[model samples]
Each structure stands twice: as C-alpha cells, then as structure tokens.
Target: MQTPVHGSLLKPLQVNEAVGVWFHFSHSGSTALPHLPADILKWSKNYQNITYGVLDTPFQTVTTYANNSCLLLLDGRIDNLATLNDAYQISDPSVQSVVWYLYVTFGIKGFYRLKGRFTLVLYSVESEKTMLYRPYLSGFPLYYQSQEGGYTLSTNPLQLCDTKNSVTPLDKQRVAHYFTADPLKFSSHPFHSLSKLEPGEIVLMDAEGVEKIRQPVHEAFPKQAIPTQKDAIYRAYRRLIETAVSETLREDIDYGIMLSSGIDSATLAYHASKLLSKRGKKLIAYSWKLPNDAADESEKVKALCETLEIELKLLSAEGMGPFDEVGSMAYNPGSPVTNAFARLNRECYKLASRDGIKYLLNGNFGDMLFKYGQPKLTELWKERQFGQLLLALKRVSKKVIPAETQVRTPWLTDEVKSLRKEKTHSETGKTDYRYALCDFHEDYFGGERYLSGVYGITRLEPHRNSALVNFCLQLPQTLHS
Candidate 1:
C-alpha cells in the first residue's frame, strides 16, 4: 500500500479547530486505506478517541453504517434535523447519524431533502464505489484529483497532492482568468491538478473512472411571480428575512454579527438583536474601523448597535497593512486569496475568537441577492426597451454601464487569453438573473466558509437562505433599488 502523504508545500494554518476529510481509492483491488497527516492523526487521537478508519474533527464527524458496508464523512449542520429525527424516531441524533440513515435508506437522492451548508463523502466497501456530494448553497469545499489507478478526494486541495513529488505547479490559465475575469465567477484553484466540486455537484467514482452530476441552477433558484405591489413585496421580504434570521439563531450558544454602516449588516443586526432580546440574551456586533477615519463606518455601526440594544465591538485596522499575514491567509483556503479585504476579515474573525464566540453571522451576500441593479439595465437593453433603459440609467450611476476594463495583467500573452473560457449565460439562461448571480458568486461563499473554519467559527449568512434568495430574485428590479 502506497501511503499518500499530505503535501507539505501548502501548509495549513494553525486553527483552533478545522474539519477535513482525505481518502484515496484504488481500482487495482488494494484494500489499504490512505494514511492521514501526522497532525490530523494526533488530533484525532487526543480529541476524537477513534481508532483506524474513523477520524473526527471538532466541527465534523465520520460515521460508518449499513453494517460497516458504508462510511460517511460529514461537515456542517443539518437544518432539518427536527424533521429527520421525527421520521427516524431517533433521539439525540448527530448530523452524521441522521445523514447516514438518510443515505442508507434513500441513496443519493436523499440528499435533496437536506437543507443546510454541508459537504458529504460516502464510500461503499461492498460496491467499491465512492460518492462525493455537495448540496446547493453549500459553501464547504471539496476537491479531488485523479491518479493512475483511481483518485484522491479531500476537503483541502493541498491534501490531494502527493508530497512524493515537488510542489504542484500553479495553473497559469486559471491565474490569468483570475486577473481578467470576474473573481466571483472564476472557480479554478491555483494548483493545476486540483478540481473543485461546484455547489450541488455530485461525483461518483468507480473502477472505470469518475462521473459528475450537477443539480440545475434553475432548480436551485426556481422563479416565482412575486407580486410587484410595494406593500406586498415589503411584507414578503420582511417575513423572509425575519424567518431566516430566527432560523440561524441558536439558543444554547451566543453568536455575533459583522456589522457595517450599510443596510445589509444593519438589517441582520436589527433582526438578530430583536430575536435574541426576547430570550434575555444580548447580540454582539463587530465592526471593522478603517485607520484615520477614512470612510469609516464605526460611528454609524455604533449608533445602530446602540439603538438595537446590542453590544458593539470595534476592531481597528490602524497599523495593519493590506498584506499582513497574507502568506498564511492565502494557504488557509488551499487556494489563492484574491479578495483585498482578506486581512481585515481575518482580524475580525480573530477578535471574535478572543471573545469566546464560535458562531459569527454576516450579511456578506445580501446586496447581491436583494440590491443587485445591473440586471435591470441588462434586461432593458436585451429587450430593446430604450425608453425604459434611459429612465433606468437616470436612476443608476454611469458605473452601472458595462465597459471594457483593462486586465490587471495587461501584458498577458494571446495564448492565456485564448485558454480563458468566459462564463456564458447558457447554463443559467439569459433571463434567469437570480440564478446567474448566485452561480457567479458561488466562490465568494466558499471562500468565507474556509476563512471562518480557520478560527473554528461557523459563519452564518441568513441572506443566503434558499427561500429568501428565491423571493428576492423574484422581486421586480424596481424593488431592488
């Protein structure tokens, strides 16, 4: 048995708790299991107390079911635990146990019933098949690489690379795409050999090879005719937001929100504070203050928090440079860190950790879902509604108009540009603005999940709730403004 060594070149950060799964399968009838890194092995020994073939991390669990015929590694919570518990009539069910039961009972199709941010890996010993599944809107990362006889799968791309060889080469084409294309739409990893599974993607591997199945984007964000009346839309929007916020709040644990001067975070803070206040609990709000008060929102955030009756904690970026801890932060996600706000984000997460907060709420993607304005103009142009287009342009800024922007790497060779595959509207269809937006921003969501995991914090985005997204997507473009 050749033990697959975890690639040391991409060293992971020293996180308080992290969840990852790594396994290699061979088509040559090898019964040997893949060896885990020393750190994971040691952590499992000290914390999980499991023997071989069973490893558990603080936020994830590995379970074997079906009389040991199947093994499952699960990360993230299951939102519909109550329904599953009632159906199975099991008390004190862990996410792993509930998922294992669903898989054994209904197979892969059962995953559709799940409604949460999670990634699952299931291996069948008897069938010699391995399945990697990530549900829709699941921000958790799952990567894989095909090898000689089979393939290796892992939550961290670095783990898939074999340390026997030199560090994996950077994918030049993907790097070019990162500079030329929209970062949110670019899904390629920096490493050439790694392949990330898209949200709602299922990879089935057998002796022959690997087959991928993806849930349609439209299905994930189905279109509905939301009444355009202002009052009706407002009522629906308010109800969805409130429900989403309520569902994300946990009674047993204290959670904090990343508040800003904008309405996005303020909305979350408002609802969260109200809900927690009912239970006699205080909601903590954390805001990042820019140095020298350069466009700082600290005062606004403070006022909002005060009005909401929640405690406000401000993290000053006074002496912190943009590239502070850039090296370590880049490796945390096992990919390139393109966001300039990475350093600031890491500092906020660090502050939350110091405050003994394990769950952090944010309104990161609320704007994309609720306040997107570009699509309104795009739809007008496509339909040849010049009159309406002009009126819309008057309401929107000149920046909303699409224009050719110079690539960051202006000297890129023609070859790299040719290799770039610009995203198409075919997958989402031209008219499905909501699906396109969600698909485009998938990477951002995954990135946040990775960064939060580094601090053992579960980052919740109530705005990304399926129902809320659907409702917001269906609202008329006028309402978005």
Candidate 2:
C-alpha cells in the first residue's frame, strides 16, 4: 500500500531558500479566504502557489499526510535527529516527518520532547483543529490573529496585517512593557489585533475557539543528579557543548560563526571549526570592529580565528550608534526593536548572506546557562550575608563584579509603572532560575531572529539546546554560582 504524503512524509527544499508558512482557518466554514497583501501573495507565489489549506513560499516546504487529513509546517532546524530516530525507530528522518510522527503518536504532548529552535504548525483537516507550538527559549517567531468566526496564522506577523481592512492598532500595554520590564519580556505582540506565541506555549484553534496553553514553570526544569568533582563537571559541560555544535552543523548548507572575544562565541567557534574541518570545510567567522574604542576585541578575535584556521570577516561599526537605521530596523521586525546593536547585527547577517552563508551560529544564552550569580552575591554582600556569600564564592569565582543598575523608564506613566511593578513581582517570585533565564533569552533573541530572516539567514544558537539547558539547570548550585 502506498503511504499518504502529508501526515507521515516530508518534501525537502533547497538549502538557500527562506522558509515560512501561512494559512487561514474559518470557524464559520466560510469559503472566502482572508485577504493577503499583494506583495505577500507575490512573494509566496515565487516558491509555491497558494492553496486553500496551505500558503507557502519557495523558502519553505509543506507536506500533507493521512490522505490530506493533516498538514504540517515547520520553520527552523531540528537538533535531535539521532535521539528522535532512535526513539521513533525511524531512519533518516526529516524535521517535518519527525514532528508529524511525534504528533501522530503522542499528540500535543509530543512537542515537549522536541529540543531545538523551531515554530511548528499542525492542522488536522478531518477534525478542523489547528495546533501551533514553539519550544521553550526558541527564537523563531510565530504570530496569529483572531477575527470574527475565524483566525489566521503566519511566521511573519506583518503578513497578518490586512491593509484593506481597518488599520491595525498598537498594543499600548506591550509597548509600555517593552520600555519598563526587566529582561524585556514580550509575551504579546506590539499590534492589538495580532498575538505572538510565547516560548513553551501552545495554541489550539477549532470550532470551539482558541485556547492557549503554557508549560508549567516547575515541569520545565526537572531536577537532575550532577557530578561533584570539578573535572567531571567540566567534562560533562564540554560534552554537551560539543554535541550542540555538532548537531546544529549541517553538511547541506554553508555556515559561519559570529565570533566574539568572549568564551561563549569562542567556544562555539572552536567546536564548529573542528566539526567542519573533518568535512574538508573552513569555518567563516564574523566579528564587529569598533574603531577607536578601547573595548574593541577585534585583535583577540583575529588571533583566535587564526589559531582555528578559520577565515575572519571583520565589519567596522566605527561610528554606528543605536539610533542609526532606526526607521528601517523598526519597520522590518514587525514589532518594537529592542536590541541596541540590531543595526550592526543586521549588517553582519547581510555580509554573511553575500558570502553565501546560510546558517549563522552564535553563543547566545551561554552566560545564562552557566550563570555566575553575581547579582545575588552582590545582594548577599549588601545584606551582610557573609556565610552565603562565602559559599557562593566557592562554587563560582572569588571575584565579585558590581551589579549594573536597572534600566530606567523615565517617561513611564502611572499606569505603566503599576504594570511594571506587577510584572517585576511575578518574575522575581519564580523559583526556577533556569526557566526565567530562558524567558529572558527568548525575548532578547526573538527580534534578532526576525532581523536575520530579512537577509535570508537562519540564526543558530547552540547554547539554547534543551539537553544543554537541562544539564546546566541540574548542575549543583555551586557550579552554577
């Protein structure tokens, strides 16, 4: 018997293409489709023609299974092919196929088992049910908008904004949160009509309406037994980092590393270079050179790249400031641009694209994963908690770095201040430090992912790997300190 395509199998796409998926589901069973902007329609048409159940671009591949009863759309790479293959007893599984198998076998709960940065959409035609999911700490963007008797979803939030209809209103609360919240939490979209799926969140839509589900904080970080010896702990940390870099490195696409003088990017570069060398490929490294700045690390970056036998591309951000390219940067992300260095990051991505790099790897979230607990230490010192401080110093470094001042929102109104107060209290009350760090990382990197997508470059951060995160969380508190 011939197997059905969409529910069980996946169709592959070219290496350089940008992947995105968009679809509309009408609860009222109306035949009329949502109005997609002409440019969006034209761009999507370049890769694949728009269909009733699927709207895809050449950059993305779509497949249907179970005799067209199910449709699966995936954006971003999966890092755990070997584990999934062994668990599911399948060989050579594509990302889409693995996701479909999991969904079929385990339902929505199967998504939690996934370890990577991805935004997935699974629609069941028979049941008229659509499920959208994003893993914890995933930077990939997924946006949806609900309308009268129906809803629309897309990887790009801009696609959901229909100019022919009423204007999309700004979400004042979200905008205020962007300015006042610490760690820059953004659980909602900047637009009132559209909503962004938070990290570790699932949205289910059907005839009954839309329901949002968030993973419990406690369940996200399960306890683990960690080695006590420093040497053993170091070995485990090294192994996890190596595995993360290895899995994210693909043979089909040319990749580059965003090198910095810091240990995080340097560590990733070292591992990535080693992996690519075995395949007879030289890794490319990109770093920002700020001329005339005493803090510039170009010299260090150059020396490290030389040692690794990697080609280094240094882009000068000499006179660049946070305000440069403000208009375009703000317009491109389809939301508020928070990262002060977004312009510089975009330039690096553009140059990488020109150099034929498909995937750009970075060491983001490294500090969070291997935290030093400096702020807590500083607080302990201030409170005269000498015993606790001594214990923390033994686990971490003896040196105590002064804590930075909180970001000030001078223009905050009374209402925004109240919102910020409530938000801060909730965030501070969380017991799982790892989960909170993941949330902060998601907010910090999500905008960067959107910015990189504009240049057709996919950003990969190995530090965000689930196994590595869980391992770090399980390590003895002293090790984390």
Local distance difference test, per candidate?
A: 0.54, 0.55
Specify the poorest-scoring 10-residue window by lDDT in model 1.
46-55
Candidate 1, which segments miss by more than 4 Å at Cα?
A: 1-18, 33-57, 66-69, 81-107, 125-127, 162-190, 292-295, 319-340, 364-366, 372-440, 445-456, 477-481
Q: lDDT tens string, model 1, 1-481?
A: 1122332211321322344556666666554423433333322211111121111224444332222344455655567888888888865476656666777788766776788877777666556577778776654667777776667766655455543232322332222222211232333334457776656667777777777665655666666667655556556666787898998886656788877654346667777888887887777887777666454556766767667678878887776544323322232334443443455666677788889888888743224443323222122212343344334333432233222422111112343334322232234333222222332243343445445444667677777678876665444333334
TM-score of each: 0.67, 0.66
The clash count for each model shown is: 0, 6
lDDT of 2 at 106: 87
lDDT of candidate 1 at residue 453, scale 0 to 100: 42
lDDT of 2 at 116: 62
Q: Which digits, one per residue and each the tens of the lDDT, describe model 2 over residues 58-139?
A: 2333332222435566666556777998987875476656776787888887887887667777766556677888877663
